[model samples]
Target: MLALLGACAPRPQGLMRPVVAAEATEQGRSVDLLVATNRQVVADPDVRYGNRRDPHLHLTAVSVAMPKGRPEGTVQWPRTTPPQPQTDFHVTRLQTLTTVAQGRGWMRQHRRGGHVLLFVHGYNTTYGEAVYRFAQITADSGVEAAPVLFTWPSSGSLLGYNYDRESTLFSRTALEQTLRLLANDPSINQITILAHSMGSFLAMEALRQMSIRSGPLNPKIQNVILASPDIDIQVFARQFTEIVGPRPRFTIFVAQDDRALLLSRLIAGRVDRVGDINPAEEPYVSGLARAGIVAIDLTRIDDTGGSHHSRFADSPEIVQIIGRRLAEGQQLTTSDIERGGFVMVAAGALHTVGAVVTAPVAVLEAGSRPVPDISGTLAADPDALRTER
Candidate 1:
């Protein structure tokens, strides 16, 4: 019955009408995206990876046009056939990589100073939606890292939530494999994960599996950002604890009024979802204070449209702040602007840092690779992305 609500609006299908023309790319700049998916490829060009799940992983290099003077944090999808490149995002170039080595070669070109940003998209998303959304985030944030996307087969139906959940469960191993492949490559130095919605759950589970089965998550995965995650608190607790030591730094974006997560909580036995946690409340506030984990609350911030589920991506201020920090390889703290959430004095400057700092453990597990001068010249033009990375 809940799923029927989506049936009312009837999502725009077959919008991925790729306009692969040389002049079409000339109309606007493009964000070159590296795509990896477990969704089965379709014969129809418009709906490339519809709703079907695939057993094997597929890799593609796609260049998506980014028109100028557009509002930030919005995807200008094509409403007509063969979208206008100067305004709508249209595909210019797409080539499937047949082998892991070929995929690595694609990364090698974008690995400016050896940093890569991998994105995992969330529930009720089509393959095209994931690609375009990631492209917007990458282009808007202006993060100077290679853009790689991992997309699982989401049914893209509002009512198909059950199928989407099971698909994520089925694709965990594939995601794990993709991570391992990225970590194993020699050209890649540092890796950061950006997982949205249910993708956050998938990311956590993959890391947990690695910790248990393969001993520990690769130290190369230095940071993880979970945006509007839809994971149950109890499940997240279990998943978080199972990840082995030398864990990466984690940042989570939360909001108290996230309607999508509210619905999620109701459906999942009335359990609290992490995305809706009120930072000032109970064990969450105190626990975050103690752990020194940064949880930015967006409950008070405005401009998140619709369901309030995508505050991290929708807000320009938040995106710029996060992108700049990640690009510089810096810890997320407060600035004068404070575009993101206010860092609660959880435990006074983070759960009494002196207590954890002064512990007699000798603090030797610092495993982050030396920050190579990864700057291949930050783009002066917002539209100019170097090497499509």
Candidate 2:
């Protein structure tokens, strides 16, 4: 009986474990955890595009340890449950990050050429919503880079509107610190940023602060893409003058038909300001033209929801443009805009006539923005312009 009992005795728990284990599992934490809540529209055309019945809120928690040495922009996605249709469309991740730009410590990593990509999400978004959006943008852009997302508390509750806005404001300082660290990294060559809706304001503020501390702007930045920003035009103009300098390539994707921005304008008590406004309609900061800032207006697309939100991820044309631009490192220009089948509103016609393109124009009515007096302005109606593209 003694011999038999000895044979049945179990080994210690630690002895049974493997010598090497994944960092997350070893720490008794999941490398990736997905929590999906709230029901929002997924816009899966086949699945009742705007059906609220489908779950829209999906959250992802990701914990990663920096690679022991310099990493060549290689990253691993978290292993989680099979993504649902709508849940799969959007990606949000809670990240464990180290601020490499804060001090001499991060300088070591910078010596290894460590770069970072920061993304800030917009309003009416849940943590899950932010993740998928980030993932889509990252993958679609072919940007194999470290991603750090600033996720403010966006209560999935619709009634939490005011709370969410307040929450975003609260998180700006923290986000700025993250950017500061990056700015100090000498080895880091470039920092790419993407901000959508309200996030644009937060990101701009952070950049503004960084510039004040560092002076002018670092040449390491490659691009700052503001998509469907939800800030007031006037405020953005002011912020641009204060923060952004003419170093990195700054591009704004505006859609005059953005209903989401319209809602944002209403909430902010601004009658005419959305992230995606026509540059021609409004005068930007004095240095804007010299800053290499390009604002492309997508008012010609009949985005089914009457919202520009879809352009960033939904529009095949925009995706193609973006993909080509990234793969070839090409900058989109007025010619691409013309070949894209959208007409530019001739600056001369701003007062007497509205811009008309081959496509049917749905949103850029005469009431939208008075045509500027600038010459060589091309205008296209939304319908006729995009029909061929």
| Backbone N/Cα/C clashes per model | 0, 33
Residue 51, candidate 2: C-alpha displacement in angstroms: 25
TM-scores vs. true structure, each candidate: 0.83, 0.57
Model 1 lDDT, residue 228, Cα: 90
lDDT of 2 by residue, 54-73 (tens): 21122223432222321222
Regions of model 2 farther than 4 Å from truth: 1-116, 185-187, 244-247, 282-292, 323-330, 338-389
Q: Estimate every model's Cα lDDT from 0 to 1.
A: 0.73, 0.46
| Candidate 1 per-residue C-alpha lDDT over 241-266 given as tens digits, one digit per residue, 9 for 90 to 100 | 66667678877777777877878888
Superposed model 1: Cα runs more than 4 Å off: 1-10, 21-26, 335-389
Q: Model 1 TM-score?
A: 0.83
